[model samples]
Each structure stands twice: as structure tokens, then as C-alpha cells.
Target: MTNVLQVIPARQGRAVRLQAGQAIRIVNTHGTQVVDTWCFNAADMGEFMSMEHLHATLGSIFPVRGEPLFTNRRRPILILEEDTSPGRHDTVIAACDVHRYALLGCRDYHDNCTDNLHAALRQIGLRSDECPSPLNLWMNIPVAPDGRITWGEPLSKPGDAVVLRAVMDCVVAMSACPQDMIPINGADCRPVEAHYEVLT
Candidate 1:
């Protein structure tokens, strides 16, 4: 059976602390949901996180079966034991904002991952709230060798999920996509749930 915990950031909620090396599962309870995620060195927040560096060092764009994801500091954070589907997700696209909203022109909806990062920063006491670009978990962002990318149909189904085993004491910041400007959230700002378990 799957374990689940719900989190509602209330339009301005942020900052979640994780015990070092604990396994965490952030679930997209709804389909077409986009999530902005990041992890920091618990002891030294300045070290921050780098998704590109992680991918390069690991030599694979996507997480392998039964592999644990780690921070830039070489610390274990999330281990992907299972992936429901190989949804073309993005690790390069940063969150959007109201100013961006204006730049992109008026849209029907407007909730962004950047806002969630802001909320999380405000909760964590500012210093560690650097808007480090996140890895979009379920949303597909396909990148081509020609340096182009596009948001494609979700590779995950309604009940599809990713399982991660956290390897270090860490702080996780997430935005349960409020994206209406892009194809990622399907023009709907949906909420997601997170769950944790103590593995023996």
C-alpha cells in the first residue's frame, strides 16, 4: 500500500524541514500537476542544490530504477526505488511570476512554483530561501540536442507516483503547481500531497 500526507500551502505557505537521510515521497495526487522541488545541505544552506550538476555527475538525465537522488554536496536525499512512468519531466525550467505573467500576457489563471519558493523562504528565515531552480517531478519538459524544449503530455497517470529514500538531514521546498500560464499544469493550479516513512 502507498502512504500519503497532504500539504496545503494556502497561497503563501513554505519551508519544510526533513530529518537527515529519511525517505520522503512527494505525491501528485492529481494528474497534470506540476511541482517545483529543491533540497539544501541541512547544516550549510549556502551549499544549496544543483539539479544539472547532479545529473551530470551521475551521467544520466533521469533517475534509474532503485537509485537514490542526492544534493550537490554529494549527500543522499531522495532515492527513486520506483517510477510509475518515464514522464518527460524538466530539470531546467525555472518557476514563473506575476511580472512574467504580464510578460506572457494576461492568462486565465496564475499560480507559479516561484511563489511557492518565496513562501518556503519566508518560512525558513530568508537566508536559505535562495530561488534555486527546481526539478519538475511529473510535468514533462522534453529537451532536444538542438537546445530546444517543449512541455508535452504528462507521462504519469492519476495514481502514478515516485518513491524516494532520503539519505541525509535536509530541508525540502516544494510548490504544488499553481501554473496556469503553461502546459505543465494543464492550465489548472492543482494541489499535491507528501508522505514519509521510516525505513528499517
Candidate 2:
């Protein structure tokens, strides 16, 4: 059976449930949109994917295809099975929030990934007070040898996709990052929609 494609609308979010051994194929339909992704235990929301633990587990900030995405409990939550992009996902930047926009001189309300995550969860009748750092798919942040980091446009092209297989039953949430203030999404600094499919 074919898995149906679902839209993660630009400047919005979506959430889906997955069983153990299942996978999600996320597509960068427009090539430039950055997807902020998060995974949580289906039975316990507190036990979710942890970037800090994942860094210590992999000994690297960049997670490659075939590596397991670990949880705060230091257990495998999901495995990045395939990636067609340049593998430049960002692991350090916090999801964009209202405060971030304020710092950017936005005096008005802006669509943000942090709010998107929580809203997505609530759509599925779930709730998480804590916003764990997300796996910023396609976000390019280059770290210099001098310990400075520079935000760069994504190197991924249109139709680039990634398959993330769940190691355990989980709920995956995704936000098409609404960061038009920077060029991390693309050279045009415009956010766009992406798509995903849950696979067995």
C-alpha cells in the first residue's frame, strides 16, 4: 500500500503518530524550506528526542544517515535511514520563537516554529510544555574553526527527501520553519511548504 502524502504548510506545523519500525519520508518540496522536526515517545511525552544527548551519543553535531536519533533517556528514538540532501542539518540553533523575532526588530506577531510545534501537538490531542530543540532539517549553519557560526542558505535542491525510521512507537511533529528574517531557508529568504509520508 502506498502511504499518502501530507502537507506541512508554510509557516505552520503538523504532527503524526508512528509505530515502532515505521518510517517517515519528509520531502523538501520547494528545496529551500527548513523543517524543524521533533519526536516524542507515544506513551510519554517527556521522553523525547534530545539534541544534547544525541550530540554526546554520536560525538558529533551533525547526524548522518544510518545513525540513530537518541532521546533524553539516552535511547534510540529514531534512525535517519536516508537523506538525499547535502546532510547539512543544523543541530545547535534553537527553534525560532517570539523573542527571536523581537530581537530581529519585529514589533508584531510572527509565525514561529516553537509555537508551531505545540500547536501541532494540540491538534493531535497531545500537549508538551517543554519545547525540545528540533532537528533542523536543511538548515545550514557553518561553524568556523574559531568557534563562530554563520548562517547560510540551504544547499539542498528541490525534491530532496529524508527517511527517518522510528526505533520505538512515537509521535513526530514538524514545522516548516517560518524564518523569513534570515536566509537559512534559501537565498530568497522565503519559507515554503513541505510534505511527508508515514511508511510501514
User: Where in model 2 is the C-alpha error above 4 Å?
Assistant: none
RMSD of 1: 3.5
In each prediction, how many residue pairs overlap at the backbone (N, C-alpha, C within less than 3 A)? 13, 0
> Which residue runs of candidate 1 sit more than 4 Å off their true CA positions?
1-4, 9-14, 106-110, 124-129, 187-200
TM-score of 2: 0.99
Q: Which ten residues in a row have the lowest lDDT in candidate 1?
A: 191-200
